[model samples]
Target: MSGAHGRRERPPAPEPLPAPTVDAHTHLDACGCEDAADVVAAMDRAAAVGVTRAVTIADDLAAARWAVQAAHWDERVTAAVALHPTRTAAVPEEWFAEIERLAGDPRVVAVGETGLDYYWDHSPPAAQQEWFRRHIDLAKRIGKPLMIHDRDAHEDVLRILREEGPPETVVFHCFSGDAAMARECAAAGYVLSFAGPVTFRNARDLQEAAVVVPEEQLLVETDAPFLTPHPHRGRANEPYCLPWTVRGLAALRGVTDERLATSARRNAERIFGLADVPPAAHPWTGGTDGARSA
Candidate 1:
């Protein structure tokens, strides 16, 4: 019924808490939801299941701004800003300045979700290469890590990163390559972030990749609202379900869930520049002298 000024009043509720699991990477700007309310609801659902910190990424200028704002809404959320490789053609030259400006913000931690995607080829190869190099330059200049999105173009991506864009910390998110490639990436000092695909029955190669990657170089992510792990297959994935992926990795690596989880957390914090994380509170610091439990 209409109340004062003919308006319907809403009931009060308690403030929502953050998730427990740490979602290493997610595309908050591309969640395909309507408005900020939808985004918060999605985050709440993730938190309910134990997912905690999330690194929400933005693939372009507008999305970058939205990501920054979203991070402001929750202390548990951080942001990564850069142009997606596929959208390189759409990114104007002047937008680089805006990216640079955003990259300087404290909330913006990494400089990507940018790299090569030969599978789709949404943007011209040359243009993608140029933009990718520019992003690397900016990351290097600002001393931030680079979050790479390489899909079916591993060789090219590796070559470019090795030649012109050697970021201090390079993270290959949703890594789908094989064991050899994983070894090479690890040897190159790049962090390999595994997603739900690693738990797929048919993803033996990806499983192998997870096994060979050293604990220090391994990180786990949901890539959520997408890439839901096995049992939850075909469903809209959320960060809260990362434990499934972590469990899968644990099995493949011959380590306990707590052990793998701790290592992954430490690796994420190290690569993501989350040094402010307290030593005792860090999951990997539970036992021993900085060595992760196997």
Candidate 2:
């Protein structure tokens, strides 16, 4: 379906990967999934292309609730819960408690999609930093990874992490750093999850950074319903499009798709612990009617 503004149509599903891997970060809610049925269908589509699992992220309260529920709806889906930095600029203090409680759920593997975003002033730097620190502490307390959303504020993000003494596991989602920043992140033993932009012709800096990342600290994602890979750049994205990214990243580093995909899967399993868990639920049948469970 095309949007009234002439938005590109959804991209066709890429070929199945030579090996299965996981999309380290994505927003199922933002993808327009509203319930169990929606979650099931999405995972099925991903699994068909060897993208066996996904870590759905929530950037707000409504999304947090749905993401958690989505994780349960399909065994293939896990979740991360947090308020986005932009959304944190001015929120009630009580909201953080609820996020914390949700973050504690066993199904929630990370606390983030949160960090600094100087690109948009939807939130002030001060407020975003305050919430970012709280999330940093929350991840430390819960002992889960911290998935960051650093935009134009890389230095501040790094400084704050250093100041607060970041949690044991830190991940920079859709990392936008150059080789220097990538080296800093890698040297600090942080994980760098790359998305579609690394494949773009003008993304030389990101591509350079991609080359420097160690295998263990490397991860891949679609960040889908957004950032569709090359050949599908302007199209709507989904987890099914992950292999395109895996293939793109592999070529950028001068490696075969299978080699990169294997490492990515291993790293994802190590970080998110979502290794080859077979789906327990059937696919969604809800375009127009009845739904089914596992």
| Candidate maximizing TM-score | 2
Residue 66, model 1: Cα distance from true site in angstroms: 0.7
> What residue runs in model 2 are displaced by over 4 Å at the alpha carbon?
1-8, 275-294
* Predicted candidate 1 versus true structure: per-residue lDDT over 1-294, tens digit per residue: 002211212112212222234678986544543344545665666666556577888777777777766665555667898999988977766788988998887777799889988889689999899899998999999988899999889999999988994978999999989999999999999999999999999998989989999888888888865787877776656566677887888899998877877777767777776655222122221233322111
Question: Could you tell me how far off, in angstroms, the CA of residue 34 lies in candidate 2 after the best superposition?
Answer: 1.4
lDDT of each: 0.75, 0.85
TM-score of 2: 0.92
Say which candidate scores most in lDDT: 2
Q: Provide the lowest-lDDT 10-residue window in model 1.
A: 1-10
Model 2 global lDDT (CA atoms, 0 to 1): 0.85
Clash number for each model: 9, 0
For residues 110-195, what per-residue lDDT tens digits would candidate 2 score against the true structure?
Answer: 99879999999899999999999999999999889999999999999999999999899999999999999999999998999999
